[model samples]
Target: MASNPYEVEHGIKPSAPRQTRRPDMSSFHSALHELLPEPSSSSSNRNVGPTPDALRSLFTLVLDQMTALRNQAPAGVDTELLQGLIEELVVDREHPDMKGFLTQDDLDALDRVPKKQLKQGELCPICTEAFLDDPYPLVVVLPCSDERIDPATGLTIHVKHEKHRFDLECVGPWLLSKGSCPMCRQDVNAEKKRKEIGNQERKKANAVDDEDEQDIVDGLYG
Candidate 1:
């Protein structure tokens, strides 16, 4: 039997195919309330909320525990969807103002590869479904890059790119919940924000340089 694509990539075997169910929002909110420390009744502390760092720590703990539980779950039971939902819930509770999903603009900015460009029998890492199976497939490539120092060579080594194509349908929801590539765990949203900041900084620097050059020319001409 052919190895399951997801299992091959992630090492966790699924006993059967299962539909991902929508998470119960009320239950998630209640659970978050329990996990987070309540506001103090004292006048001085009543308005204080959990610090961002504290919330981040709690989120990491919850995700780690949930991932372990999913790995240990009986085969054929699908807990991956639930795990993602819980993660989004935690993010929402911790930082309500923060956007957790890729905006439409972000999605539009992704490189769309033609379906024919995909190798035969290629499957989406998220759903493990063959991309060609769908009559109409919208495929997008993730911009993922990672590097590590080779212990033996003591030199920086760029990791070889793996299968990073996915049906938009399969990956969209996952990115919406996590703002990351499901296969690589690369934080796509965060990277985009960093790039935007870099661009802004460059523009500011160029403007200052242009102003300084103009001032120098005026002084020389006068």
Candidate 2:
């Protein structure tokens, strides 16, 4: 299997054991709300979103907290993953055009799979930790069908199985920065946008066909 580019770039070994001490979810959530306050209902601020500075501050705050948590953990707990993520975010901040981050809506739309459904040995491609390891694992299935069109033959090809699962925490930041499957390097957001456009075009064609049928009926009767 081809190596995930992100892993290769960051020197992340998929076989590394996950850190036993998980970051506090509530603390992170609290930090997020504090950094990016909810928009007011007033007409002046109704549709306004957080400024770039605000977002930068939030990222810094989260990274600092994560680093602190990592420091408190026992030795041999892999911290490379978190450091790799921070480096990637820094690069993304420097070069805005390089970012292919997924939107909140895109992340929200992913299918969540219960931890119990995953096999015992099944590991998240990003963190390489078994899904069952986390007591409250937030596992989500990637939308990649592992299907592609053969440019030479003009035929569709199935590269592999349709479902690719990952730990939400492990994959979320990756998708937010890179917008691709960590396992196959499939462009998730691009595929989603393509499907949406296809659906819209099909709906438009159907509408036109309906109108044409109505016109034909009127012509014959009148």
- How does each model score on lDDT? 0.56, 0.60
User: For model 1, where is the 10-residue window of minimal lDDT?
Assistant: 213-222
Q: Compared with the true structure, what per-residue lDDT tens digits does model 2 show for residues 23-111? A: 44465556556644463434464335455665665556545544554466457656565566556556545543323546455678888
> Which residues of candidate 1, in runs, are more than 4 Å off?
1-100, 148-162, 194-222
RMSD of each: 14.9, 14.0
TM-score on alpha carbons, each prediction: 0.43, 0.55
The segments of candidate 2 whose C-alpha lies over 4 angstroms from its true place after superposition are 1-20, 37-49, 61-83, 93-105, 125-128, 144-147, 150-164, 173-188, 204-222
Question: Per-residue lDDT of 1-222 in model 1, one digit per residue for the tens?
Answer: 578898889988767644332222344345445544553435464235445665555455445444444565556665566467456646655664323445434666777878778777786654455677766667888766566665654544445244777766555544533567765678776655655775586568768775534233224421
Q: Which candidate wins on lDDT?
A: 2
lDDT (Cα) of model 1: 0.56
